[model samples]
Target: MDTAAYALLVFGALAGGFVSGLAGFGTALMALGIWLYVLPPSLAVPLVLICSVVAQTATLPSMWRSFDFTLIWPFIVGGLAGVPVGTLLIAHADPQIFKLGVGLFLLVFPTVLFFNRTPMAFRFGGKVADAGVGFAGGVLGSLAGLSGPLPILWASLRGWGKDERRGIFQIFNWTVLLAALCYQAATGLIELKVIWLALIAFPGTIIGASLGTRLYHALSDRNFGDVVLGLLFLSGVGLVWSTLGLR
Candidate 1:
């Protein structure tokens, strides 16, 4: 690759890894725009998935004490069950319209939450509600590779603390992204070129992820919430931009 492409690749990986480490999600949201400028969607998308898994795994050890299996299992179960359903739905769905709708939701919902600092106090439905959000996230993930928004939004609305929110979404993202990576591998989407690109990107991902984890340790609860909201807002912009590009 030329120096410009190489630089963009490293920069994208760094940004993606940092966001994932700091917020428990958003690797693709931060990286894909830059990567897409240099690589085809075929290569850029899988590379985002691979780097995301790497970033999540690399930073997880720091949050090991906060790992709550009882809290996260329902979401995982619901997500796994929903993936096949989503895969089926993709056959009948209009992908661009689906992305546009999700893009709009991401834009409006986060803007509302950003303005309203008071967290909602509704605590009903317990794990069942969590699972339902996970199921929707899984369907979204399969449909548009967008599994983070619903659960993350639910966590915010439920008034979870920073660590608790991170614990839920981080582990959940790791599981879902890893599963998707494996599916790609099984289906022969992970080719030698992707491997080579990953090799180019891995160093930046690791370094950026490590730096982001340190920053995460420094954030107060309110500040962390702001960061998460900011990322979501940016994700909305990216989604809307991509959807509009199709027209």
Candidate 2:
């Protein structure tokens, strides 16, 4: 990659990583902008895995105490089961449709909680729900390198506030991202240039995720939810545009 592209990735790494740490799921949106600037979407998804995984690892220890392994593990299993399916669909399907679908889905994801009369009782969202969310995460993740919103929404609906919610997101993001990364690597989609960019971006993500863990107290629960929703909306629009080949 050229200096200009590398530079953009560097800036994206620091900014996105910090946001993810603070907000819980902005890294994908942040990196999407820079990745689009430097490469095609197809190439960007695999590259993002490299950076996302590092950020997740960095933030893991801080959030470990807050983790609900029972909740997370089911999703991980489902995500693993779904990644290949998502990858296969992505490999041959039309990109524009994926964008529109994801955009629409994201736009709706955060709103469901606002209007729903009955919330999901604990028992209602059990192993099946976790697996369902995980499968969705893997599918979207493989398609757009974005899959954080679903899990975030699930947590939000459960009355999980800012800090813990972000922690869950960090862990979940890494799970799906690392899984996808492994798939991409096995399939030879990850190029040398992608690895080069990853090397430069990883440290930035690590630092930012660390800082986010420290600054988790700064944001209010309402604000955290709002920001996450807004970012998802904006990122959704961006993804739709990308689907249309506009970005």
Candidate 3:
């Protein structure tokens, strides 16, 4: 790669790492959008997965004390099942259409949350419901490298505290992205170029994640939720733009 491409890759990694560190998700949403400017989807997606896992793992030690297996296990099981299905669809499905649909949902869902201030008061079913959301997350993870939005939105609706939400986001993202990375490696979707880019990007990931985790610790639960919602909205806009060939 040229210096310009390398620079862009590093910058994208830093930005995406910071976002993931703060919000406990959104590494792909932030990095893939920027990386796609310099690399194709085939290359960019795997790089995003590598950086995401790195960022999430970096923050895990801080969140381990608050981890809730009961809430996260069902989602993991459901998401694991959905990933292969999504991977299969990638070869057969029109990705632009899928992106458009998901973008619309992301846009509308946040608006609903913004208007409905008492979102948590409305119970959104039980563990079965959580698993269903996780399945959707897995499908999106495999299809778009964007599995966090659905679960992030669900955590908001369920009225989890910042730590609780972070626990879910950190563990869930790590699990799904790690699995996706392994799948990509096994299928030979991950190339040597992607590995080189990951190496170039690692330092930025560490720096940004360190800064972002500090910021995350400082924010109130309400403020953190608002920030997450805002990022989701922006990610939706990015998806819509890409699907329309505007980016």
Candidate 4:
């Protein structure tokens, strides 16, 4: 890679890693925005998955106390089931339409929530609903390395505490992303060049994630919620702009 591409790659890794470490999810949301400018989707998609797994794994210990298998298994089961289906559909799906739909939802939903100031903790759907959200997350994860948003939104609506929400984001995304990466490898998307680029991204991801994890420990629950919502809003903007060629 050229110097410019290398710089962008590392910058993307740093940004994405920091967000993942801080929020327990968002590596792809942050990284793909920059990486796509320099790397093709095939390479960038799996790279984000790998880096996301790395960032999540690195910070897992910090969120370990919040882990509850009973609370998370439904999502995992649903997400795993969705991955191969996503792989099959990618070839037929229209990328632009998909981006526009997700981008608009991210834009509108987060904006409304950010301003509402009402704590929304709904208990209506239960575990089945959570699994359905996980299935959607898995499909998105495979399509664009985005398995966090749906579950994140659902957890927020469920009014989980910061650590509880982060736990879902971390463990759920780790499971889904790792599964997506494996599917990509099985389908030959993990090329030698992608591996080389991942090597280049490693140190930046580690450093950024380390720093972000430190900051995460200092934030209040309210502050953490605002930060996550803000990032989601910004991610929405990035997606819409890039998809519409306004970037």
Candidate 5:
């Protein structure tokens, strides 16, 4: 085994897992810096997927049976389709542009949400909106490890029910992560080493997500939303720092 690689993988798993719990996402954005230090970016992608799958799967139970399927299915269908396109886009995009785009979104999205008394709320115009989110997710997922965040951000800003958000995010993320993992694996980006690293993260992700589920119990709807959104902002800042070679 690669001792140094293994060590970083373990630590990354722990940090990534906790963040995933406290927030609904950020597992990849938080862990990627550390993972890339030991492994290639291509390999990092699948490892992220595996760890995310573990995290989201564990959290799905609390979210299950609480979703608006009319809403869930269409949006998820979009996300499922969106992720692979995003994955493919990632391979071809210019690094500088990619960095700038993610940076802008990270900096702007949360600020807008924080300042606004009310965001756009919901823009679903029947099934079309669902397809649009999926397509957006697929496109973004193809390019960046983040696909579900935009749709999720809308959900967060609108202050949807915790169970609905969790359930919706679980399906959206799971689909994106799984699809991205497949693309990486088929392209030979994933190796046994990565799988081992993902395995190491499994326990941590599960534990953290479980804690979040429990924490959800005591929070008022507004507090829970604030907590998750706050965590996402911090995570975004961390990513920006890392991208700038500061983290």
Candidate 6:
């Protein structure tokens, strides 16, 4: 890669890592945005996957105490089931259209929640609902390297506490992202260029994640929720812009 591409990759990694560390998600949204400016989607997507795994693993220890298998298993199972389907669609699906539809939903859903005066305690989704959300996440994960947004929105709407919500976000993302990585590897989508970029971006990932972890600790639950929503909104906007072929 050229010097400009290398710089953009490093910058993307740091920015993406910080968001992932703070919010337990968003590496692809942040990093891929920058990477796509300098590299093709083929290279950009795999690089984001590798760095996302790294960022997620880095922040896992901090969130380890919040892990709850009983609450998370359904989503995991559903997400796993959806990956192959998404991978299959990767070759045939119209990504721009798919992304545009998801982006609009994400943008609108959060806005409505933000403006609602009486935010009801909405904690009535059984495992089935959770599994459904997970399946959607899996499809998105495979199709766009974006599995966190749907689950994040679900947790937020369910009125989960910070730790509980983060447990779902961190663990769900790690599982789906790792699964996607493996699938890509098996299909030979992960090339040596992706690996080289990952190595070049590793240090930025560590630094950004460390800083974000510290920031995460300082925020109140309400503030953290707001931050997550804000990031999700930005992610939606980014998706829309990208799909329009504007950047």
Worst 10 residues of 5 by lDDT: 117-126
Clashing pairs in 3: none
Provide TM-scores for the models: 0.91, 0.86, 0.95, 0.97, 0.86, 0.95
Instruction: Give the winner by TM-score: 1 or 4.
Output: 4
lDDT of 4 by residue, 44-130 (tens): 988999999999999998779877777788888888888988888778888888877888999998788788888888997799998
Superior candidate under lDDT, 3 versus 5: 3
What are the runs in model 3 whose C-alpha is more than 4 Å off? none
Clashes of 5: 12
lDDT of candidate 6 over 1-247, digit per residue (tens): 7888789889999999999999889898788778888988788877887888899999888879877878788889989998888888888987678879988887998887777646556766688899999999998887778989898888877787788788898899899989998998999878887887788999998788888888998989888888888888888898889888875
Give per-residue CA lDDT, model 2, range 126-210, as digits (tens): 7788678878887877666776877777776666556656666776677788888888789877787777667788888888877
Please list the C-alpha lDDT of all candidates, in the order they appear.
0.83, 0.74, 0.85, 0.89, 0.69, 0.86
TM-score of 5: 0.86
Q: Scored by Cα lDDT, where does model 1 land?
A: 0.83
Give the per-residue lDDT digits (tens) of candidate 5, residues 1-247.
4888777877787776766665556677667667878877767767777887677777766666766776568767777677666766666787655655676676778777767756345645656766786678667665556665676776765457776676666677777777777776787767887776676778767776777667767777667666666756765676577567774
lDDT of 3 by residue, 1-247 (tens): 7899889999999999999889899888888888888898778878888999999999888778878888888788878878887777767878679778888888889878877777483366688888898888988887768889998899888888888888888888889888887886888778998888899999999788888898999999889988988998888898899889984
Q: Which has the higher lDDT value, candidate number 3 or candidate number 4? A: 4
Q: Would you list the clashing residue pairs of candidate 1?
A: none
Estimate the Cα RMSD of every predicted model relative to the unseen true structure: 2.2, 2.8, 1.4, 1.1, 2.6, 1.4
What is the lDDT, from 0 to 100, of the residue 86 in candidate 6?
Answer: 84
**Deviation in angstroms for 163 in model 4?**
0.9
Tell how far residue 72 is off in model 2, in angstroms: 1.8
